[model samples]
Target chain A: MANLTTKLGRLQMKNPVMTASGTFGYGTEYSDFMDLSRIGGIIVKGTTLRERQGNQYPRMAETASGMLNAVGLQNKGVNYFIEHIYPTIKDLDTNVIVNVSGSEIDDYVKTAEIINELDKIPGIELNISCPNVKEGGMAFGVSCAAAAKVVSAVRKVYDKELIVKLSPNVTDIAEIAKAVEDAGADSISLINTLLGMAINSKTRKPMLSTITGGLSGPAVKPIALRMVWQVTHAVKVPVVGLGGIMNATDAIEFMLAGATAIQVGTANFIDPAISEKIVEGINDYLDTNNFSSVTEIIGALEI
Target chain B: MKKFILDLQITHKVQLNKQNVLLKLTSKDLLPEILPGQFAEIRVDKSPTTFLRRPISINFVDIAQNELWLLVQIVGEGTKRMAEMNPGDLLNAIIPLGNTFTIPTDKNAKVVLIGGGVGVAPLYMFGEKLNRMGYKCVFLLGARSQSDLLLLNEFEKIGEVYTTTEDGSHGEKGYVTQHSLLYNPDFNYIYTCGPTPMMKAVASYAAKNEIFCEVSLENMMGCGIGACLCCVTDTTEGNLCVCTEGPVFNINKLKWQI
Candidate 1:
């Protein structure tokens, strides 16, 4: 009950726990088991200007404690989201962060421009980090100039809060995280997925059609934690950290590492209700320990 | 529907015929939402070494008692452990996922159900539902050996059943296509789910004959939904998430990667 209520930049969340995009599919599919309004926010699947057909067979491959995917940014497109999915999710009490992806700068700006016209949607999480597609994805997020260019273009057209989702596939996350910060991003979300692959071994053929894909789950946790710590210090803006966050303990570790908020990604693949369970777990930890608000715990770890 | 890490208590595990095991599960409120062909991701922790969840197709559901059946073939570590499960042991299953076979609008016409390998699981359920609804149904099931044939008596109860095995071990020798050739089969629609090669063969035969056919696909899935984009199939429209766009697809609409 204490500091559980928090702010990820200008966008306020009832709690820091939110569903990562592509995991909680526009927030209505899991309503059978989870109540939508209870959690902090929902980042719907990655959106594009045109509906993406995605990749070929075996687009996903399972790894040690994680999975690799090359889904190729498949969604109903921005226009479809505004018509079909938005009316269903926008009015819900939780924050609806529209995660927009694009193959070009104009595509992102156009997607953001359409989203800005929506009434109840609070912010836009620019997904420059998707690794599966043939187009922009990591190609944009990995370069300093490219990162700044995309962010700058969207910032000009969209006045809403901008959260730049950073890709772990990059060489120096801190440098690129700072580039987006200078480009006028309101917050940073670190460590989408570490690029990796798994092979069938017997057939001697590649496990995924893409041959390589985005790696997520607990296998990427440690590296993600380090990146969150690195980027948080490099940028002045708040950071939203996500990668293999299974429990409240894992989420708190990210918060201590300087993430103003956090998103639970691959964990939902195993358990649909994990976000609510994590929200409850964090609340219990704060209540029993006499901590007031979750925001106070953000970066509370002393050196 | 609510997806749960359901602890399905295996009530009876038996080698029903051969190379085939029938599991009777006592799960609460699971059958109400579960349909045929849609699978459950099972965490077979018979031991930690094979800890990853295994995907298994649902055979049938007895809604009245909430009893579920799975026709499992020993393929890998996950399934071998599943075959060894006892009456009270629980297995974690994420059920009613992907999608189900499309039901035809014409309840007045005859329907044919085709299945291959353990793909028979869903066709059996589909036949059961359509049979109860007053539609005429013929179920064709094929396997490699007589030992591979499963649930013959069960299918007999639902509708007219036909069987075929590769080496002449059962009712009709050769393939399910032999059964298809014999009957005027004058069917209004056909529904199928099986191994890739088998479905392709059946779809090809159906296509040549100009009979309506729909097939359920099996793919390696990370997330059972569209997110991971792992379960994909090449089509005329391009590529699609088999889990969401379909684990069930109209045969004519699908551009099978032959």
Candidate 2:
């Protein structure tokens, strides 16, 4: 049997397949469909210090092979999560990570400080790449200095594995990845949704209420792969590849391109069991190829 | 509250009109307990444009025979593909989703159901449950023409059925809002699911006459579960997940202009 266990800084997961933040609403939502314990990790939705109602109606629009969303981090704040959501999911036999977001650095730090008190939460995927929110989401993500500042501030309070999620809307993604690493980031996950727009040509109005939103799904996979490969080489910290991964083949490709782990995002909207299926497929592929451990294939691209 | 993902076999497909089809599917496995107003999400395979599961309401369920009915309209590519399926074909569905309509406390109360276009799809199950429970049911359905009005006989088997066609080719010569049966709001309760204009009108009339009322919303959704924040309906309590919190909501909770 191949060893599928992998690590993100101090955090260790049984496998390399984890659901991306915001896509998997806590770990409990999919418990009826698949075994939550079989998956490597679960990154809950984008949580903030205070309850955010998010954007207005028509938050999602479907495009060819992809979708745009402006759901503006509509979570009920971290306090609700710790009090209500945590007790329900903490007992699940899997790594439950929180995806923390904020409109200000203080919001980010305070949220992390509360999560640090929880023993069940293994890590947090610091979200500096949310494109839908007006304030701190993509603002800190696009610039090296802002990215480093958020990471540094949160790193001071959050003792767990800190995975800095980077935005794809920057001029050079690798530069931003390196900045977070220097800011004491334990790991990096890249290619958060690319900003895109769609117009209802008949009505001559924008499809999403935010006018422009983050684009995700198979349409963004190729670009996500390129960025993951670049950032994996640019920083010494482990890189988690995401953006538009749909299936096991896509997950394996990300791992081969140098990602130690891969997160499934929009694909969950299509198939709730996709993350579990990808885990099974990765094991099957490793066995078929005569590989002894899953880590042996990381960054093993022949080119 | 129990949910199941099952591969159900298509037993029959009855085309209601040029636009709608009634699909009867049976499962060999013991079906999970389901209530009226809940829906199922069916995956559309082999279609290029449809990558997401289409959410459809449960129209009828014959628990004795393990039969489930889905009323589908050819709204887009996804529904178009569902309409073309043949009997004996297998369809994977996630079912018993969302909350059921609140059954009135007074079983003897007079109740009315209003549906607009394909929005009337969920009323069959709602009417069936009410009829079997001995509640008085009055259905007011709206469509474009005589052929556009769906499942009149099925609803007739359970309650008093009324319909209005845009072309006036059916029971009433105007919209459902103008139906004579609706003039008196002395009913104990009213339940509605239909076009926004019709629902707003019904909510307005019900509110004015002090009739307790509820309306089902047809918001465009992704992941019929609450995970995706795509399907949201604003209420007095704030924005709630239409998929989990409701597809059916009391009129008082809704922040509609009426």
- Best model number under TM-score: 2
For residue A89, model 2's alpha carbon misses the true position, in angstroms, by 1.5
Give the Å error, residue A253, model 1.
1.4
* Candidate 1: tens digits of C-alpha lDDT, residues A22-67: 7787877667667778888888889998898877777776666777
How do the residues B1-258 of candidate 1 rate in per-residue lDDT, one tens digit apiece?
Answer: 555667789888878765669888977654547876677777776343452356677788888868888889887666777887788988777776767777778888767888887888878888888888888888888889887878888889988888889998887888887774435747778888778888888788777778788898887765675555567787766777677777888887788753
Residue pairs in clash, model 2: none
lDDT of each candidate versus the true structure: 0.82, 0.90
**Second chain only: TM-score per model?**
0.91, 0.97
| Model 2 segments more than 4 A misplaced | none
Model 2 agreement with the true structure over A1-303: per-residue lDDT tens digits = 678998778878899999999888986888888999999999999999999999988888878788888899998999999889999999988889899999999999999999999999989999999999999999999999999999999999988899999999999998999999999999999878999999998899999989999989888999999999999889999999997888899999999999999999988877888899999999999999999888999999988
Give the winner by lDDT: 2
For model 2, the chain A TM-score is 0.99
List pairs with backbone clashes in candidate 1: A2-A292, A2-A293, A3-A292, A3-A293, A3-A294, A4-A294, A60-B230
